[model samples]
Target: MRKIPRWLARAPIPVFRLGIGGLLTKRLVMIEHRGRTSGLIREVVLETIKIDGDDVYVISGYGWSSQWLRNVKADPRVRMWSGWGRGVGALATILPRAEGLAVLDDYRTRHPGTVRALATGLEIEGFTVDGPLPEDITERMPLVRIRPRR
Candidate 1:
């Protein structure tokens, strides 16, 4: 619900690049979008999961409240930097809420560590925000599938 801090956004770029450069399976991408409110360019490093063919999916524990979600909504045409030196320009489509939930379920089943961390974030005392995909989001969550622009 809050805009990402400028410093936090800028700080992670190098680490992301380093990780992506070092790891083969770990594909970190830089998603570039136009901010819905400010109309300014924004970028975020996201972990991408490749679906069938060129399709890619991203799920946020914060759901549609995240700025990246809003930006994608505002402009589906965006640039994706895959790994350290690869790039893909794609059209991002918001999948049905049910599909998003399904993807999240798959993620949970595949990555127990992620599920546990998310669960802890949701249930722990200090981290009070609802970090898990809520029923409400299952009803209206934005699940995006990015496809290469032809």
Candidate 2:
């Protein structure tokens, strides 16, 4: 995918910080994590893949290279905000390969337009928005499930 301008990418952060992200909460979520090295708290707005009960799933199209993904791996603990929710404690689970593929499958089945647009942006070889998803998709674009801590 073409790189997004840094300014455009960071535009939503201020919205979240100002506490108005709920307007798009059904489609987006804001997650806060401790930096792996800096140990400072960082926030990012990510697209919501699915919301099943207390589990909220999202995919890192940038894959493991995404700084947030790397940091989350270092520490599974995180805080997230969605509709009518703010700073809700949660745990980040990197979905297994098979499960990631399954989630992508279901997501595509449910939202073809969104998946098609996302797949177009992803530009991963053998990973189509419609056709059978590649088995290695998880490694290329990791899917994560964030569940509120009980």
Which model scores highest in lDDT? 2
Q: Which segments of candidate 1 are over 4 A away from where they belong?
A: 1-10, 14-27, 122-134, 139-141
For model 2, residues 27-130, the per-residue Cα lDDT tens digits are 88889999999999988888988899879999998887899999999999999877653578999999999999889888888898887676677665665655
In order of appearance, the predictions have TM-scores of 0.71, 0.92
Backbone clash numbers for all candidates listed: 0, 0
What value does the lDDT take at residue 35 in candidate 2?
99
Identify the runs in model 2 with alpha carbons over 4 angstroms from their true place: none
Model 2 TM-score, 2 decimals = 0.92
* Candidate 1: Cα lDDT at 61: 41
